[model samples]
Target: MALYDHLGAHPEDRDGVAGTRFAVWAPNAESVSVICDGNGWNPGSDELWGSSSGVWEGFIPGFGPGDRYKYAIRSRSGELLEKSDPFAFYAQHPPHTASVCWNLSGHRWEDAAWIDHRRDTDWLKAPVSVYEVHLGSWKRPKDGRRYFSYAELAEALCNHCEQYGFTHLELMPITEFPFDGSWGYQATGYFAPTSRFGTPDDFMAFVDVCHQRGIGVIIDWVPAHFPTDAHSLARFDGTCLYEHADPRQGYHPDWNTLIFNYGRDEVRRFLTASARFWIEKYHIDGLRVDAVASMLYLDYSRKAGEWVPNKYGGRENLEAIDFLKELNVELHRDFPGVLTIAEESTSWGGVSHPTYNGGLGFSLKWDMGWMNDTLRYFEREPLYRSYHQGELTFRSVYQFSENYMLPLSHDEVVHGKGSLLNKMPGDVWQKFANLRLLYAHQWLNPGKKLLFMGCELAQWTEWNHDAQLDWALEGQPYHDGVRRFLGDLNRLYKTHAALHATDCDPKGYVWISGDDAARSVLAFMRRTADHSRNLLCAFNFTPVPRPNYHLGVPVAGYYKEVLNSDADIYEGGNVGNQGGVYSEEIPSHGHKHSVEISLPPLGAVVFDALTGQAIPPRPAKAIEAKALPSNDSKRPR
Candidate 1:
């Protein structure tokens, strides 16, 4: 019965006197009191009575919503402590920490149609091109305002996302955190939206607008660990009540924080309640759980002698695994279409599989392997790329093992790691072309797509959390070209069923020419589930063009060039097949039919076969490459 009731401050009529009822968990506290603005911060005047269940409860007459408060607890060790409410719906803006009383029930939602449609939608088969955003730095005011309010952000962000053809917006954590530098990863108030943006209602309005604009929202959620702030969950009630007792299991070495004690039922319930609160009250579409690898492994970032083994003598954190499985199960059970994505980096099997099958139950997991290898492959000089072709083709070998989201996230462009455009190995002209090629490959690949905010505008510098993106670059031709290219790519991805419907199925993809490593080229075909439509894609990694490059096809037909990254509109060299090419009965790369067309340098071209007919092979010179690699530079078959 207690679990069904609100846990924090709530307005109620107590004996016909309107006041706020406050409840907090402090099992080890000798005495507890609510200190609020209405009570003039007097603790003794608003004392709370404790129950056998470990919750302290009290009612303060004349104190209602909009009042600010904190819990003053006298621990068993004779020490007094003041801490903010963990279940607070809103918090004071950082640099000043206090819980603000907020009622979560009153806001009017105008997205019922979006919510209703999502409940019955099949997200796995849907196009999910995501625009990952960090609210603080996405855009800042020109008139000296440091940050936009939630209402202001809703209009700006939704307009940008809608114009860019992004299906979803994956926001960096908005949960209450102390430091802006940590980017909300080190959360303190699990149930409150950061007041840095606006009130709880304002955040709700932001979400409502996202839904109204048909853009799904997936927020980064950090349940793995929290900062050791004096006013936070750390050492609450003069003990490690929310975290583990032993430092080996409780402390996070990498972040210098305290990890949640998943083994404790109270802590588990608290975290689960936070998850449910966001979904049920705030109407979030998904949770992209952060740093899951740190939670999954007991020995993560620790020396062999420094870490403790589990009861089974393994590195796996059993309690954390159980908690994650339960979290996914509950979320999926309650919200049918809501996604739970994992940022698990290790080769942890079954990260996205069902818990019933002895696997972690997440809807999707970021493919860290693909991101690393793909970036490494692209960052290398084109001459040296032939030796590392495995990095390009290696992903297809295991792409279908689990549900994946290819994330070019904020993590890739921070801490001296340059921006995505800067990561390419080339001059200014080739740089934009290479980035377009990268994005083209990413979208056409067999997975959902997620690109960090500034990538679309080809921002050359790494992300700065304190400053806004280079919005002025949008007027530049090269940057504007990249932006236009991304929009077109997104539109194409959304319009084609072959691109997304069977993203997780191996049957949807086939290799066309993966062995042309000598020329630094890759060709593949993406097909619909029923083989009704096929989109052929080809990429050239080097800066050298290959004119009349023969690419084999399963069927002979007129292949129309639907997309060319090298087109003049994209600020490229504009070297490509005119509009379409005809396939002849040329046995190449084990295919009976093939097309001979000019492949542009540092570009990606996609084609759709519009007609089919039996034809004979053209002359060798017509079908063969205009130039082949030197004899010593051999390509694998």
Candidate 2:
């Protein structure tokens, strides 16, 4: 039986009468009672009877949805504790720690067509570009004092995603966090959607709108740890029921939160149920499992002798491994198209493999190593980039190890890390050019794409949860150029089967030139499974434009300039081949044919091969390079 159906307060017909059935798991409690406005907050007014299985359940007549309630439990030590329901479907807004009764069965869903298509689709071979968003901060009220309601946000966010050509929206954790500063990472409500936005039905409507507009929703799921709030699951019934009794085993030193006891069957069931509940009820297409590295290791963030080993005397959290495998198996088996991605940072093997094969069974793993190395390389001055050429080329060694997603996620721009645009080492124009180069590299790389919200705008300031994105900058030349460039990149990525069809297979990728460290240039070819289409990709990491740069091509024909980061529309020097290049019979870089083109400064360009007779090039003209714009004074503070 589903624990969610029986554990939380459910509107049910008990013995031919309509009422709310309240149930909780507080085994060590001497007595438990339903405390609400209906009972005047009296602990002794409406008591529940306990069962041998550590469950306390009771029914209250005339109690229904929209009622605020909490469990008042008398511990074995005679201490009365009021706690929110762990299985609540909806919660009161922060600063109000009550679980509000909600009926999730009332909303009418209109995404049947989308759901059917999703189930039959193979996402591994499809274009999966994600726009990571923080709904509360993506856009707020014009007054800047309150968050936009779910209904309001749905329309705006969907329009934005559609306009930008994003296939999915990966929202940061929205599971009813108490502190806005935590940015929903420290979740309090496991089963409830934070009421800060709107009602449960309102959230359902938000997702419905996204689906109708052809955008999938992926939420960050934080099953790694939870906060130590007094009214939460830190200590229940005067005992460490949900967490471990030992501090070293139960606590997360980094976040000062309590880790779940995965060894306990009830806790495992609870977490797995919560994972299923979101997909089953909210129609969430994916769950980005957060902080998975912390869960897989017993000695995570712990000193020697601080943690205990398992039966085999190993450091791995055996219980957590089992739980993860089980969770993935059930999620995939029950929900055919639902995706479970792991944000695991370590070199854990087969994280995206199936559980039946002794793997963790995640659908995708965030490519953190590539993100770090690429950023470190891009942050360096152009003169020093040649020495660090390995940063960009090293990905080819294990690019297909797992189903990876190239993520320039929110984690990169928080805690004084600076924004993506600001992290580039250059003046205003060079910074914008480098940022565009970085995005082009990410999209053309052999992985799926996931970019954080404000990154596309080229925002200067790091993300602040208290405020919304810098919308005013959207009209500026540089910022608007970056936005437009990203949208075009997304469109190109989606339309080209050669870019995504065999993303997880090494057969689709081939290196044309990877050892040109002196000029800091890299070139490769991406092809479809059957080699029907091929794209030549090259990047120049310096500010000096290379005119008549010879690059190798597999076949001799006309190569169309599909995308150029240095195009005038993207606020770069109009430096490129006029339109397309004809392959020469001369050999270069081990290829039978070659094309001579102008390589832009600190830019990336893609060329699509046309296998027809070579076309005559247009008459050469002196392309006037535009002057780079200076930094705007109206930057976000």
Candidate 3:
């Protein structure tokens, strides 16, 4: 059937070495030669033995592992093409210096064999909290000299993410981008991890550490385009080897790069195989497909004759979409627990929908519009900018994505936008309060979340990868307080069953409204554990305090304020609110099924409803009763 099923590189066993033969389906090539390091510093020994197919094979001793190589391709004109580094894992300082054939069986995988939850449906039930990082930038030096080894970074970063209570780790593309500051978006090699980091094995060690700590890793994968670097997949064999010759298929105008021709069979194989290679080889938990919207529309970044399209001449690029669907389907089928997250911002249907529903099979899509809307609202001064409308404008578009992450990404903090904390327009107290509002609202929203590196500590300045975060500021009262607040927030999120339980199920949440603009207060309840469980979330955004602010509860019982962002111990003004318990009985609509509670001023609180007895979230009932199914669909927000 397929050569990939049997293809592998091995030199230990003589019989296996005999089975190892080179094959390249270059239909137009007049001649080809295989280069080998086995030959003693000579030029002619690289010549390969001609095979039945367009492939060339030979039995050369000591030229198997860690040997740099490429195919010397000859065109019909007898002209030699200065080709790309074919087996190029380490396209480093000098470029195309060497490449070693990947040995699959060498790695010692210690991952838990029993853990295999499918990534697509996994987010449907589990609470999703993502930590987005650029492996290089997140921990680079202040002097712009040292880059942490992948191993060192792995140890520190994964532990930090685990401590932060995030479920997923989304890395910016680490597929060997040519330029460092382009932030891994400009990829040159899709199959290999960046040599700038540690070795391929070293990268695997990072993933291994992540698995041990129960964190899922997702990389920013670019199937949309490639960098314009010379020693790359483009023009490899004196022609468009991995790309297309025609302008219709090869150019990326916005980024000045080479785009893949997905319609071509070999091109599809290259991309799809690259996807599987990461999931299977590195054991990456997911892939966040970058610039999906650019890939979807042919008119993207258009400049008249410089672009071309499919036969139908519609705005759509059907080939890319077709390949995307196939690739996602194949990924899920093979790995099951691997996620395919799309970074698409269009109204393209089924983005976060199931594959069976005639949609692209992305497990989740970034809720960018919601982020922009909510952040803009947060930036408005005095907590008064179309106050009532700002209350839940973000919520409308938010509920669309089946699974979404509320991201405070690097994009927002760059180019004079400032940090999320710096985006606030008030004094120190007001700033902290604003930060509280942003985070509390995010926690209450019906989605998972992603926070950039320094946002947790409320880093005042905008982000710059050229240096480490202002870690020295931890000694300052404001910074230390913010750190405590963040750490506590994580504890609160995981401890409460309602906050993250049954994320996709509507029954897990309800709106207990005090929806008033003048009062500038809104209350919602997250109900995930059981009817006996409730988390009363109330936010007071107005400068003026609401006296005797009464909020209705969904369940009829005692409720205790378990956490408060405006607590006096946390450097917040004591004038706002004091939280204990609401023991008062409520009579509303002639039904005694709900309780009344007091609201806080410029404060956010989460209260747990008290059951008569300690209520177990999902306790086993009598065996005679019909067995209730366990909740397996964890909807990552």
Candidate 4:
């Protein structure tokens, strides 16, 4: 059970008296009292008795549910402080910081079937494509600036997820935060679901609806640091109870937040309990831990002379590392199907490996390098891309270092960074083409996929926390084409075994032609664990079609063109190998057989080789053998 159940306000019957039991931890306080609506918010009216362990307990008759409360403590140093309960399950909608007492039991959950399936499922081999969303901005009430309630968001969000064939929905933090601009990153209530949308039960119903629709929910959890709001956990008991006393260690430079004292037993327990509470209470499928790189290092954003080194004279924060390992161990041990993903940007070794093998024990880590390099490559003009071919191929060196999730997340489109569609360097037509190619590349690559909400719609503007997405663009032909392409890509990714089976294994990916830089083309083959099914992916980076482009394949039968980013349905030039091509016995790129293809301009084509089966060709026009001139005579064959 979580600490919230033991501490804070809970409904209880003591000696036949129906009342609420209040327990709080204020180790350094001289006196503690529950200041609530029943007591007219007076500190001395309902005083609590203290124990040796620093906990104070009391029972207030008739103060059970729907009461607003705060803990008033007189510090040992003769100072008084009023703070919200850190273990609060629901808080007053912010701008008012009182913790609300509410009963968390008796809400029925209908996700038993989903829970059972999750436990027996091996997620490593599963097709995990997450659609990252900011609930407030995903959609809003049409009448005005008022937000959509959780119940409304549940049906709308899940419907969109099902339409796009997304396997999971990764929510950008919905925890309680005072400032709307912070986008819930500076969370005040760790255990409480933000009341900005609705009540705690409303949020629970939102999650329930997702599970009913077969979409897993992943919340972005921020345990890295907290906002220094006065009413929050900043200086409870008029002392640095949750944070460190020293500014050099506790204060965060970048975000102006306070770091938690992970070394302290109570603090560790509080953080871990918060993590467990969400999984146990809300039935969340996974937790994508935010700013993990900041937690792992003591000098993350500080100068060498300004930071304090660890006891071992190293930059690594040992306590935080231990806390992470323990958190992962406990969560995985207790919740069999729950996932813990890290947004770690550094080259940290073994981030997703097992804890028993001297690793951090996370299920997955975000592939920041892949995201950066791929974006950098796509942002360059096609004429200059040949010189930067390494940008596209560099991931092969460290792709299998961790169980990676390739995320084109919201971070990339905020704070002056343009949206994904606007980041491409090209004319209007080529821009949409480049965006389609980017999505195809992400899906065809060997990793799990995560796309921020508006990228699929090809929205031109950057993400704004206060404003909703450009829903009007969905009706535009070009914008609708991108959305259609994404939906098809997602469906193909989920159904194809070769695309997701060995996403984390090296044996699943093989390079067919990675050095065709003159035309800025890339070709790779994705295979199943037993090599039973194979997918040959080819990309033409420039807006120049290449006909009679022979791609190497392991099999000799017909290879079906499963997906084409340049198809007319996707608002492209429609250049491609008609439907399927027969492989010839000409050895190319060290393969026994090869197929000639019409590679589209700034497009991606995926060919599925149905091995050991007779594949009848679909009706289509025959592709003419008109090969484009290559700078390298020794190009693949």
Q: Which of the numbered candidates is closest to the native, going by highest TM-score?
A: 4
How large is the C-alpha RMSD of every model relative to the true structure?
Answer: 7.6, 8.5, 11.3, 6.7
Task: List candidate 1 stretches off by more than 4 Å.
Answer: 1-4, 611-637
TM-score-best of 1 and 3: 1
Candidate 1 contains a number of clashing pairs equal to 0
Considering summed lDDT, which 10 consecutive residues are worst modelled in model 1?
A: 610-619
Clashing pairs in 1: none
Query: How many pairs collide in each candidate, listed in order?
Result: 0, 0, 14, 0
On residues 421-441, what C-alpha lDDT tens digit does candidate 2 reach at each position? Answer: 999988999999999999999
lDDT of 4 by residue, 539-628 (tens): 999999999998777777778899999999999999988787889899898999999999999999998886554577545988899998
Evaluated at residue 176, the lDDT of candidate 1 is 96
Which ten contiguous residues of candidate 4 have the minimum total lDDT?
610-619
Candidate 4: segments with Cα more than 4 A from true spot: 617-637
After TM-score superposition, what is the CA distance of residue 232 in candidate 3 from its true location, in Å? 0.5
Write model 1 residue lDDT over 29-97, tens digit each, in one string: 999999878778876768999999889998888887888899998999999898999888888988888
